[model samples]
Target chain A: MLERTKKSFLTALWILIITFPLMGLKTVFTGEQAEVGIRADAFYLAGVVFLCGMMWSMKGLIGRGIAFAVPPAKSCTGAIKTSVMKVPVWCWQVGILAMLCAFPFMGSEAELNKYFSFLIETLIYVSLALGLNIMVGMVGLLVLGYAAFFGIGAYTYAILSLNFHVPFWPSLFIGGAIAGVIGILLGIPSIRLRGDYLAIVTLGFGEIVRFVLKNEAAVTGGEQGLPNQHIPGAIAAPSLGFMVLDREIHYYYIAIVIMVLVVFVVHRLNNSRTGRAWIAIREDETAAMSMGINTFRMKILAFAISAFIAGFVGVFYAARMNFVNPEAFRFEYSVLILSMVILGGMGSVPGVILGAVILQVIPWLMRDMMPNLLREYFPSAANVAGTLTDFRLLIFGGIMVIMMIFRPQGIIGNARRKIELGVEEERD
Target chain B: MFQHIVDGTTQGAIYALIALGYTLVYGILGMINFAHGEVYMIGAYIGIISLAVFTATGMTLISLPLCVFVAFLAALFFCAAYGYTIEKTAYRPLRQAHILAPLISAIGMSTFLQNYVMLAHGKDKFDFPGIFRAAFINNTVQISGARVNYLEIFIIAASLVTMLCLHLMIRYTRIGKAMRATAQDKKMAGLVGININRVIPFTFIVGSALAAIAGVMVSMYVGATKFDDGYMAGMKAFTAAVLGGIGNITGTMLGGFILGLAESMGIWLISSDYKDAYSFILLLIVLIVRPRGLLGEQVSDRA
Candidate 1:
């Protein structure tokens, strides 16, 4: 025990040895180029050292607490699965549909606008997460550049509509098709690579897409961005008695309808033979190939299908935003979408939706809704409220780390995925 | 043309230093330390702060080199602690989890650190003190119709010396042998009584320390450091690691130099506006054509 304590202290000593120069010197020495007014404060140095030591000492306790609190993922997910199974599928579906349809009528303009906008954004991310789910969850390909497809879809639609005057409805399919083609192009090379290599390739491809979009100024309008995108209104002539889908509520319904359709299709696909092939590939590629799954074709198919959905969302995204920029599609966005899939429970339809909603809505509530509510009581809250928006990523990263450590299977984790995650497979 | 080479060499040296962190961590753990870049960023911040402290104390009045040495040491120490802490908090928990878990955790660490620093420091670039203000570094020499700054010479020499020391340590040191053994086979190494836990974090410490040195070098060279500086530079170094076949130290060095020269020469040959795209493009091509990279031996089929 004494030896172990010595070792632990030595570790702390090592940390202090490194940290002393970085923090202590900063507080004491100030900086080489600092002006005369600046002076090193002893208090700050003491505080930094104390903090470091505290963190170092508490490390073991924290690790143990986290480890102890985190129950095996299998049990947690099994509980979720059983509870979900108790509810009739059709009843839940109808209930969701009713709630969505009545959402706009629930509140005033300010409230409705906020909820409607939040719902729309959440639904868009759902689609993105669902698309990523096919690759990461179903097929087990870690794509770090999934947002490139999202961008591709948006750009294809923007360029086609802006240049060729393509109609919004047709442009949506065309955009999706173009994205699918790009996916296939990417897939051909990626099929040979596995895991981290595939991730790097996709990441690189994403950067390439962004650079091309940014550099090809004539087509993408460069940094100024392509603006004034055509929004889809009235499925037909307004005189035919159909409502023109120009309002936020109309957009909300349209987005929800699309989301429901995507969920349904993804659910059906999950049960299909192709989905089984994907599962096989995910489980063990070599085994799946030997079993004659045509792993390459399925992988490409997954990529294409995933890209198609992203493209579909991209059209609606462009329409809703009424503008498109290369900046909108970045590598970080891909990570965000990927997080939704992973956090929700990879390879599970309901899991992805839950993940998307939770991740998106939490940030929305923290950054926008919470501040709005808080500022109503405390007028001075406005200044601090704005900074909450800046902390969004910090919170996001913290959640991801905590989630991975505590609940790797996610809130609504798939059983197979739990197994893949190395959670002890509980015999139910 | 020669000036581009000189510039490329300095940039490449820094990239090599950063790449060593990536390669060392990857070699030991079989996981890409995505947050390694953020660790470098923290080092840069520390470098700036330490310089301010030194200047405040009038330490330059004593000896400029001594002052700079203290600042570099400070940055190195803090970054090493950050690196070790990150491993303990974000990585250790997910060591036995699926591959994606650690990667996600790393991404989270990266995002968290970036935002945390942004919040603490405010979202503005800080000016870095130029440590090497001596007559040698202040002057430039004409080489093949191009001006080569003495600072560039210093950067190259510093990078080479660091790499040499690291190579010697890894080859001759007891801890280095243990690290190598654990990297080769963790279970087997443990069976042979090697302390896996200590070895892993130690690897992180050394790798992070190297990154700190690189970070300080970079800030000094550029005369400024920003919150997001780590992301692009990290990506470039990551590219260099992959280009040289990740986990191979010598290959990482070669990859860094090659990437640096390629970017410099490519900009000269073509356009500078898309300079950032060069590394990504090279990474894609390499992964597609030769996943093993220039000097990477066969990575086990598992990863």
Candidate 2:
């Protein structure tokens, strides 16, 4: 009764807030010469608000229902505790709202587009990190060939969409499926290995994939890469009563939506039976196998799922960047992703997100900010200094070392996760 | 094709030297000692610096023994210090922790050492002076329509001498016997009044010096040395060590030659860019098929 009323109230409040922004956007764009579709913004906002409302209501219901069903004294303390919290929900809401609000603040149209493009790129990394976290964090599988899946995804989209003229949406799924299959194939051999051996094998796999991509020039276009990929018609135009897909903000919304979907699915999977199986295998494979769990199957599943996510992101990257090249997928990228997973906290989702954002944005931000900041203060230093990118690899390597020495558990490692990582395990 | 084999053998000899360091440490310590590669890099840089100083004073034609003596001393001291410090600071703490922790630290040390050199010296490839670049003998042995450079002979000879010395040290010396005992069982060695600590450092010093000599030889052959050169060469050498049954000295040497030959043949058959890929692919296949490596004992008792 009270919960129902509260949910209704929240939903109404969300709708009203979204409508207010929609109205503001409509009026602002009315006088502009750009063929901006105010309706699309309204629709997107409504969808976002509705999704938030649903998640909020679901959490409320789950919490109260669990409390009602499981008597406080009788129920296990941990079981009764709510996993869904308001903090992450609010963070997501506030972040998205802030980004959406910035749409109207751009002084010029070009700046607005650039901002949108940046958001799309951020989304790609977010998706990739989430996918990688599945293998490295959740499963405790140290896959050095993570970028191979990304390549698989990219190549799948490139070959299918470019050669077969498949629509972007369908090809995206196909790419993910193809990469997932490849991941499983790789994971099969990986089941027999552990630790360093596993790392070496995956590293080899990554090289093999890269080599094949380079050698199969007839199909992959070799070093030149596939260019001028076509974006799907649905997203290409302002259709389905939505605004045209012209602005960077629209692409940003698309990326955000995809990231949200990936995050939601991964979060759910992390708490599922399959997720528990992965954890069990990671903890002790021999013991896990003794317990009737097929360790090989579970590992393969984790790999496939991770690869699928990478594939999904790859499709978006191809569409967003409108370019695909082997240079973008390199061992360095694999190392970068691995660093993100390590630095952020191996098993923590939020930590992976934090790592991704820092790794992706810091270098670019440093590149832009350092030169001007340094120039204004010390004019002579500017003349002798090279670009920040020049020292980026060195800085990154230094950080990896420092982090390993001081905080191998990563920045936001969970206590239980730390223990499982062998912090508490006694050695002979 | 014959010339390629000769070149491969020459390169393989250098890899064999570096692989000896990896194999020696792994044999004694049961640790990867990832910093071993950086020791090679540092040794090369030190050799170049020492040689440059010597050549500036017109001692370009110094006696071979004197040159080897100075280079060996520098390599021995610097590498020993590096190896000891790495063990004490990075590894000793994590000895009881998860295996991954030390491995990560090793990677960190490798990166730190590489970058330390890069920053100290500008991020550019430094050329080794031409003092040792001259061929000791100018004649080429023609075999099956191919010319084999006589420099190959010197590399093979030098590597053989080093290997023979190492073999003698391990088999005949008291320190060598202590090392073997420690490798077999650290606790037992300690109980038997062997200074395990002393033996470990000695192992490191010997291993690192070998790597250093290999580094100088490689830089000489390649004509230039980059601060980041250790990554590729080190990886290849490490692969050789793994291929040769990790903890076995003779196996490591054999592994180096095999890997070198494979890489050379791969370059001949395909593109040079694919040389690394081929070696790594071979490593992957070998690891999957035989985790124990060639000539390695089946230690199926481990959990």
Q: Please, what is the TM-score per model? A: 0.89, 0.77
After TM-score superposition, what is the CA distance of residue B30 in candidate 2 from its true location, in Å?
5.6
The per-residue C-alpha lDDT of model 1 at residue A361 equals 80
Model 2 lDDT at residue B177: 94
User: Whose lDDT is greatest here?
Assistant: 1
- Which candidate number would show the highest DockQ if scored against the true structure? 1
Clashes of each: 15, 1
lDDT of each: 0.81, 0.72
User: What are the per-residue Cα lDDT tens digits for candidate 2 across A361-388?
Assistant: 7665555556657788888878444645
Residues B180-263, candidate 1: write the lDDT tens digits. 898788888999999999999999999899899988878888877888889988988988988898888899999999889888
TM-score of 1: 0.89
Per-residue CA lDDT of model 1 for A301-415, tens digit only, reads 9999999999888987876666788999999899889888888888888888888888898788778887887788877888778777887878888888988898776767786
